[model samples]
Target chain A: MTTTEAPAPSASVIARRLVSLHGLTRLVLFAGFWLVFAGNDPQSWIIGAPAVLLASWTAERLSRRRGRDVTLGGLLRYIPFFLWESILGGTDVAKRVMRPEVDIAPGLIEYKIRLTEPGARVFFLDSISLLPGTLSADYRDGIAYVHALDADEDLLDPLRRLELRVADLFGERLGGEPDA
Target chain B: MNILLDLLSVLLILAGAFFFIAGTVGLLRLPDLFTRLHALTKADNLGLGLIMLGCVRFAPDGLYIAKMLLLWLLIMASGATASHLIAKRALRGDGEDY
Candidate 1:
C-alpha cells in the first residue's frame, strides 16, 4: 500500500516550531487573553492552561498562510482614524434614521484595491463595511464592489485614504493614485 | 472628581441609548435588507462602544476596562464579518445554501 500521508514531525522539531517567533506571539496573546478573561484566580488556571495552549495552537494552524506583519507605528496612527471614521459612519446612519424623509442614494462603486497583501485586503474590506456610507458587497480580481448609501456623495477620497492606511499598516507600497 | 465622572458617564450612556433607538427605527423603516444591515451593524456597535466607554468610568480596575474593550472588539469583528457574509449572500441571491 502506497503511503500518501506525510510522516509526523519529530517531537524536537515540533517543540522548536512551537517556540518560533510567530508561535510564541500567539502563545503569549492567548495566554494574556485567558488571563484577562478568567482573572487571576488560581482555580481558573486549571481550565485556562489547556485552553490557552489549544487556542494558540489552533490560531497558528489556521493562520498558516499569514500575510505581512502589521507595523506598530502604522497601527497607532490607524486606530484614531478608524475610530473617528466609525463614529462618523454611525452618526451618518443615525441622522438618516431620524430625518423626516428617508434619504439614501444607494449605488455600487467598483473600487480597485491597491494593497496586494491578503491580510491588508481583508482588513480594508472590513473597514469599508464600517466606514461612512459604504459597505463592501463583493471582491473579484483586484477590485472591490462597494455599496454606497449615497452615490452622489464623494466615495473615492475616503476609500483611497483607507487603502493607503491599510497599505501602510502592512508596510506595502502602492503604485499610484486610486483609479479615476 | 467622582461627581464629574458620573455626570460624563450618564451623558455617554444616554447618547449610547439614543443610537440604539435609532438603529431599531432604521431597521424597521429602511428600504431593504442591505440598508437594514447597515443600521444593525454600525449603530448598534457604536451604541455598545459608547456604553462601554461610560462603564469604564465605573470599572473597579484596569482589568475590568480591558475586558470591556475586548468584548467590544469581539462584537465589532463579528458584526463586520456577519454583515459581509449576509450582504454577499443577498447579492448572489442563491437560496440553495440556506
Candidate 2:
C-alpha cells in the first residue's frame, strides 16, 4: 500500500549503491558470523576473511529483493511476541495430538497480504507455519494460501494480527483494513 | 545457584523431550501430509527451543550460549522454509506417493 513512489534510479547508480551499501553490510554481517564460529584465533582469520568475503559476494549476487530497513526497536518488540506465540503454538498442537481421540479439521485458507515488501511477505509465509495450526502453502497475486489444521476456527483474526506485527517489524504501513 | 540451574535445566529438557514425543505421535496419527507437517513444526520450534534454552542455563561462556542460540535460529529458519516447500509441493499434487 505504498503510494507516491520515488523515481527509479539508473542501473549503474543502483549497482553502485547495492555494492557500496548492501555489499558492505553483508560483508560486516558475514564477518560477524565468522568471528562467532572461529573465535579470536589469528590463524583462523587467514582463511575466514576470504571465506567471509566470498559469502558476502555470493549473498549479494543471489539476493532477489532489495534490503529493507528493519527497526531495532521493532525487532526488540517482535521477539517477545514471536517467542510467546511460538510457545503457545507448540503447546496447542501438542495438546491436540495427545488427546485420546485425535481430532483435526484440516483445510486451506487464503489470506490477503497487506504488506508491500516482498521480503516481508516471505517472512509472513515462513512465520505462518510456526504459529498455531497454520502452514503457508503458497502465495499468488498478493494472497497467501495457508493450510490450516482447523479450518473451522476463525483464522483471519490471527493472520491479521501477525501481518500487523510483521509490518511493524519492517516499519511499513499497511493499507487500511479492507472488509474482512 | 548451580544446583538451581541444574534442576531447571533438567525440567526444561524433560519438557522438551515430551514435546518431541508428542510431535512424532501426531506425525504418525495425522490424517494427511499437511497435518503431519503441522505436527513436525511444533517439534522444530518449541521442542528444540526448550532444549537450547535448557542448554543455555548452564552454558560455560558467552560464546557457548551465543552458539546455542545461533543453532536454534538456523534450525527454525530451515525448518519453516522446508515445511512451506513441502506443503506447496503436496498442494500441487507433485508428490502423489503420500
Candidate 3:
C-alpha cells in the first residue's frame, strides 16, 4: 500500500499564495459581509468597507497558513444540507427524549476517514457532532471515535458524503493510506 | 391579516418553548454525558431556530431580520463546537479508566 505524505512546500507555495491573494474574491466576500453588518446604509460603508477588507485579509492569511483555500461555491452548497441535517438532528433527539420510555442504544464506533488533509479532516470531525445522533469523541491515528445514540443508526453513509463534500470544498481528493 | 400573523408568531414561539423544555428534560434524564450533549445541542438549536423564525416576522426592517438570523447562526456554530469538545473530553476520561 502506498502512503501519502502531506505535500511539502516547494513550487506549490507560489500558487497557493496567488490563490489566497485573489483580490476580487476577497472584495466580493467583504461586500456580502458589509451588507450583513451595515445593510443599505451608505454612510456605514465608510467604516464597513475598511473593516471588511482587513477582516478578509486576515482570513486570507489564516487560510494561506493552513494551505487550504475555501471554495465559495462549495460552501454555498454545503450550507443548506448542513442546516437541514441540523434540523433533523434536533427533531430526532427531541422525539427520543419526549417518548414515554427513553430508548437509546449508545455505543462507541470507530470511523476510518479517507480525507488526508488536516483541514478537511478537522472539518469532517467537527461536523460529525452536528449531524444527528453521532458525536466525534476522539480522533487519533487516522480514525475518529464517535459516540452514537444508536449503534445501529446508518451513520456511515452521511459521514462519507460529508467527507466528500469537505474534500471538494478544499479541492482535495482522497488517495492512498494516511502516513503513520 | 395582522392578527393572523400575530397568532402564527405566538404558536411558533410556543413550539420553540416546548423544544427547550424537552431538551431540559433530556439533559436531566439522559444516562450519560454524550447522550446529554446530544439532547442539549440538538433541542436547544431547534428551539432557538423556531424562536428566531417567530421573531423575524415581527422585525420592522430587513436589517433586524438579518441580525437575528446572524445571531442564530453564531449560536449554532458555537453550540456544535462546544458539544464536540465536551464529548471528546468525556471519551478521554472513559478511556483512561477502562
Candidate 4:
C-alpha cells in the first residue's frame, strides 16, 4: 500500500504567510485572555483553548485577506483626534441640553472620504460613529455620509484631524497637508 | 488577603454602579439620540467592565477569571459595534448628528 503524505501543516503556512508579529501579538493577547479565564479549571481550559484558537484563526484569516497593518504607536497618535472629537461632541450635547433651540443641523453630510483602503475607510467611519454627534450613513467610492448634530465651525478642525488620523492608520498620505 | 480583595472588590463594584447610574441618567436626560448614545455607550461599557473585573476576584481559579475577562472584552467589542450600527442608522435617517 502506498503511504499518503500528510499536508504537513501548510494550512498554517498559507494562513500565516502574510501574518505579522503585531497580528500575532493580538492573537497571543486573546489566547492569554482565554487561558486566564479558564484559570485553574482544567475542564474549562480544554474548551477555552479551542475557542481562543478559533478567534485567533479568524483574526489571522481576516488580516491576511485584507493585508491591513496598524501599529500601536500609530494608533496612539490618533487618540488626541478622537478625544478632541469626543469633547466637541460633548459640548454640542451640552448645548442641546441647555438650549432647546440650539441649531441642530440634522442632515447627512456627504463627506468624501479621502482614505483609499476600503478596510481603513470603514474603520474610520466606524470610529467616527463611536464618538458622539458623528454617524456614518453609507460609504461609496471613498465617501462617507456623515450625519452631524450641529453644523458649526468648531467641528471643522476636529473633523480634519480625524480624517488625517484615519488616513495615517490606513498608511496613506492622501496628497494633502496633515490635519492641523 | 481575602479581606483586602473583598474591600477592593466592593469599591470597584460601587464605582461601576455609579457609572451605570450616570449612564442611565444621560440616557434619560440627553436631548438627542447621538448624545444619548455617547453617555450610554462609554459609561455603561466602562461600568460593566469595572464591575466584571471586581466580580472576577471571586472566581475560584485563573481560568474562570480569564473567561470573565474575555467576556468583558467581547462586551466592549460588541458594544462598540452595536453602538456604531445604531448610530449609523440614526444618522442615515433624518436624526441630527450634533
Q: Which is better, 2 or 3, measured by DockQ?
A: 2
Candidate order by lDDT, decreasing, is 1, 2, 3, 4
Residue A165 shift from truth in candidate 2, angstroms: 0.3
Tens-place lDDT per residue, model 4, A36-142, is 65455568767887787777776555443344567677778876666565444444444454454444555556676666665666667667654556655555555
Better of 2 and 4 by DockQ: 2
Alpha-carbon shift of residue A54 in model 1 (angstroms): 1.3
- What CA RMSD would you report for each candidate? 4.5, 3.8, 5.3, 8.5
List, residue by residue over B1-98, the lDDT tens digit for candidate 3: 99999999999898899889989999998999889988998889889998889998879898788888888888887887788777776767764545
Per-residue alpha-carbon lDDT of model 1 for A1-180, expressed as tens digits? 011244565555555657898778878888889888988888998999999888866565445354678888999988999899889999999999889998897888889988777788888888998898898887777788888888899999999989999988888999866683
TM-score of each: 0.91, 0.90, 0.77, 0.62
- Candidate 2, CAPRI quality class derived from DockQ: medium
Tell the DockQ for candidate 4. 0.22
Ranking by TM-score: 1, 2, 3, 4
Please report how far candidate 3 places residue B46 from its true position, in Å. Answer: 1.5
Show model 3 residue runs off by greater than 4 Å: A1-54, A64-68, A168-171, A176-180, B1-4, B94-98
| TM-score preference between candidates 1 and 4, better one | 1
| Candidate with more favorable, higher TM-score: 3 or 4 | 3
TM-score of model 3 (first chain only) = 0.71
- The prediction achieving the highest DockQ against the true structure is 2
List model 1 lDDT by residue over B1-98, tens digit each. 98999999999999899889989999998898888888888899999999999989879888798899999999998898788888888887875755
lDDT of 2 by residue, A47-123 (tens): 99889977865555555456576778889999999999889889989988889888788889888888888778888
